[model samples]
Target chain A: MAAGTTSSTEVPAKGAGFPPFKTETFPSQIFWLVITFAFLFVVLWRIAGPRIKGVLVTRRGQIDGDLAKAQSHRADAEGASAAYQSALAAARGRAQALAEENRQRIGGEIDRAKADADAAAQVEIAKAEARIAASRGEARAHVAKAAQDAAIAIVARLTGDTVAADEAASAVRAVTGG
Target chain B: MAMNPMEQFTIKPIVPLHIGGYDVSFTNQSLLMVVVAVAASLFLTLAMSKRSLVPSRAQSMAEMSYEFVANMIQSSTGEDGLKFFPFVFTLFVFVLFSNFFGMIPGSFTVTSQIAVTFALASLVILTVIVTGFARHGIGFLKLFVPKAPLALLFLLVPIEIISFLTRPISLSVRLFANMLAGHTMLAVFAGFVVLLGGAGGVLSVLSIAPMFLIVAIMLLELLVAFLQAYVFAILTCIYLNEALHLHDHH
Candidate 1:
């Protein structure tokens, strides 16, 4: 086929005049053109065209959809982070409030117990003072009695005679008072 | 031997026919047109048969061409301009294949003919005009109305109108001329090798220069083929852009 075509098209230097300039050939050329081009347009429009376009449209759609998905994912991540921050702050605030409340309650309990202990000590101190006063009075009484006995006995021995009780008490009281 | 470089472009009748008064014969141009369409269709069909997300080489190629034109439309006319993707893609593939097919040793380049390019160029302009009018109403004609002062409107508006009218001509000529010139130069250089070889042994040795030059031209022609196809598609995009959204007069 190649050889046959090559020979046929080969330098057939026999053609008369410039074929392009000749007007005689325009009709057939134009006719075939109308027929062939119209046929080509139809073929392309009906078959070749939509096929390629379908592929292209689908590819473009896939790309756009992917981009949108990525965008939504990023937005979701951002929303999650914001939620975490707010939740964390809220949790921290709640914990601080609980600690402050606990501290106040404990401090109030300590103050009340301290005041109660001070009052109890005051009452015990009053009782202790009364017991000390009573003991002192008893000791004082014993000492006075001893003085009186000692004086009276000394006087009786010196005089070689016993004095009267009322007189001895009077002498002891006077001397002690003196 | 004297060679005619213009001879390759002849639209010889492979199946001559007549319909009423028209010479609607099947010519080499017609043959290549059908061939280009089929080849393009087959490539797309086979490439996408699996429709794998991770494309095979052939699938990548098909997708690459798809994205290539898609980007062109997007840049020139925005996403809304994608409405013309099928037409533009069809035009791109057809022109690209036809240009490359012509580069083959024994195939006719459909783009070499003025009629073929003119038809395509006209079709583009027609689409722009119709769609522009339908969408924008009389504002479509505002394409010719200049934004300059009334003093220059006399000059700018006329010039804009003429330039707009000449679009199809210029567009058609650009592709046709490039293909025609490249092929003609290659043919001329190839003829030189034969001409030089016939002169003498020493001249035949000198013929290697022209022979190598032909190779170089062939490579250049390959680049031109792809570039011309790109230029055609991009220009169509730009034209469509103007029609879709009436650009400010510049």
Candidate 2:
């Protein structure tokens, strides 16, 4: 139930005053307020406050550590890439050197084989020249024997006498200039 | 049907107790204060029980509120102001929960009482004065002295001192008046609905008007509740900033 406003004046009579302005309740309200508020402050300061701060600090430290780990991983990857590239280049240089050496060796072998074939052809030409000279000398001697036989037959028929073998030979020698 | 709008602000003692001849009885006001404190504590503590690297929905909410207050203090008072973080955080949560809980119909709005608001405001001002003196020693008095000429110092100094003295009054009155006025208006409109509805015939139908108005006022009150709490916390920060860094504003 609601209480009616007392009298015409703004102030209400005793025990019916505006509840907010009532002085009697002040001590109790302040007393309890102080107690509850102080309790709350202590709870927050001791328990809740430290817990929150710890969580936040831990999260920050973890993030920093993770970032540092990521940075090192990236550096390791880069180093590996550089090493791989250098190894590939060295391998390529070695292959080229091997190819160049093989080409030079093959070129020298081809030049030596050509020189041996040229010297064998020169020896066969000298042997054929020597055989031709010997054959020419034998042919000239056969032609001189045929001429002497023909000269002896002609003397026998004309003089009706046989000439001496030595004389015939001398005659033949003089004519042919042997 | 004609109810007194002021009836909602009444303080009835739930459990009577006499301590040293003073009436420190447990009242409805006291009940809500305990509830607010417990609820705020549980909200933060239970939500953070897991303490996972990645937060859950409840945990995120807890963290967000913590960071929200933390950032507010940081921006206004800088990092050094963070030393008072627990105090500022408690004040914000208490006022916020009290306002929200009061929105539930039939629940008491503790901040509406001048005693409670005044106590809170006084605590803030007192902290400011103490911190200023502790940090700067005698230099704290320089807060009232401006960089003006010698002749204008006399006039400006008094004005500054008066404003400084009235900080608690203004702070307390702002929250109390807003809550009291808003609640009172809601009560009055709700009373109008009952009155009009009981008048019978066409008057009953017209009661819908006041009912709609009540809804609108309620929405506004919700906004007011949050705004007042924010205003209280921010003003506290600004005052603390002044105490911490006197003459830095110039």
Candidate 3:
């Protein structure tokens, strides 16, 4: 099979276009193959390899960037949800506190009103008692004065004009049938 | 009539040049390789040069060829495989044009010859070697060894080594044998048609049957041409896999 290297059929004559290499020589096809291989290696290493590497690197970076962005967005969304929850709690607390304060204030006002009413009623009752005492005293004084005047008038009529003070009292008592 | 149509399948010299113990003959085969290479480069470059957004017919053809290589790379090696697009493209175009060109009468099929196939196979192996070395450095030698159950290494290492060496041989033989056998059969059948012909010879008329069979075989050969190119590129990808993913201990 080594002689299978003789790829040419047969060399006929001088003018025949025999390949530069013997049929048994290095395969001419190997020459072309080497040339092709070298050319491709250079082409790929220089142009295509760099481009492909660039694309792969860029794609990787893009994926990494996207994942980072997604993570950040998730954090932001969580923060927003927490903020909303806190705000809602604060608003509810404020409303409840306001209601409680209102209830306490109303309670304080009702107590004050009751105290004022009690004080006013006490003052009114004291005024009524003072008025009743003053009227009773005046009536007692007027009754005494009227009784003495009646006694004097009866003594004068009975003793005609010459009766003495001591006699007059006694004569008045006798005249009136006391 | 020639004794055998296979006999006519010869590579005689067209121009003989001798240089110091070197038998340098410019033969039909060499001329055809030059033609195949030149035509491939020219056709693609000329057709794709304008780079129009809306492709012209020539540009469409160029784009189709580009798409073909690109798709082949993607399918064999996955999308990450697009990195090898240009190399794969050039190889496909060269082989495709050469195979089709060989089908023409009087044209030499370089790929049909073992030397040509061997050269191509060697290139693939060389790429694997260089890429593995470049990618893995000295660690590439570790490809032959199993890192686990040291006893299993006894069983696996030699087989692994043999398989590794066999890549180029199998790659070359598969392409060469298919191309050579197909062409030879066609020639042998054509010879039958000629040798059996004569007046009142029923056997001569029956020779037409082989001609029909040859036509069917030719169609099969065309399919083989595409298939062989595909196999070569895919095998390159598999070899590249070794470079990308080093063997685990197991």
Best by DockQ: 2
Which candidate would rank higher by lDDT, 1 or 3? 1
After superposition, candidate 2 runs with Cα above 4 Å error: A1-15, A93-178, B192-219
What is the per-residue lDDT of model 3 for residues A70-146, given as tens digits with 9 covering 90 to 100?
99999999999999999999999999999999999999999999999999999998998898888887875465444
Report lDDT (Cα) of residue A104, candidate 3: 99
Instruction: Mark the 10 consecutive residues where model 3 chain B has the least summed lDDT.
Output: B1-10
Write down the lDDT that model 3 would get.
0.68
lDDT of 1 at B66: 90
Q: After superposition, how far is residue B90 of candidate 3 from its true place, in Å?
A: 2.2
What is the C-alpha lDDT profile of model 1 across B1-250, one tens digit per residue?
5456776787878898899899989999999988888888878767877777667899789888999999999988898999899999999998999999999977899999999999999999999899999999998888888577889888988899899999999999999999999998998787788888888979978999999999999999999999999999999999998888887422
Write model 2 residue lDDT over A23-118, tens digit each, in one string.
999888998899889988887788777777777777778888999999999999999999999999999999999999999999989888878887
| Candidate 2 residue-wise lDDT, B81-198, digit = tens | 9998998988888898888888888999989999999999999999999999999999999999999999999999999999999999999999999999999999888888988899
Cα lDDT tens digits, model 1, A4-77, are: 22232353434435679778888889988777777777777787777766766777888899899999999999
Model 1 / residue B90 / CA error / Å: 1.3
Superposed Cα deviation of residue B51, candidate 2 (Å) = 1.5
Candidate 1 local lDDT, residue B118: 94
Report the number of the highest-TM-score candidate. 2
Output the better candidate (2/3) by DockQ.
Answer: 2
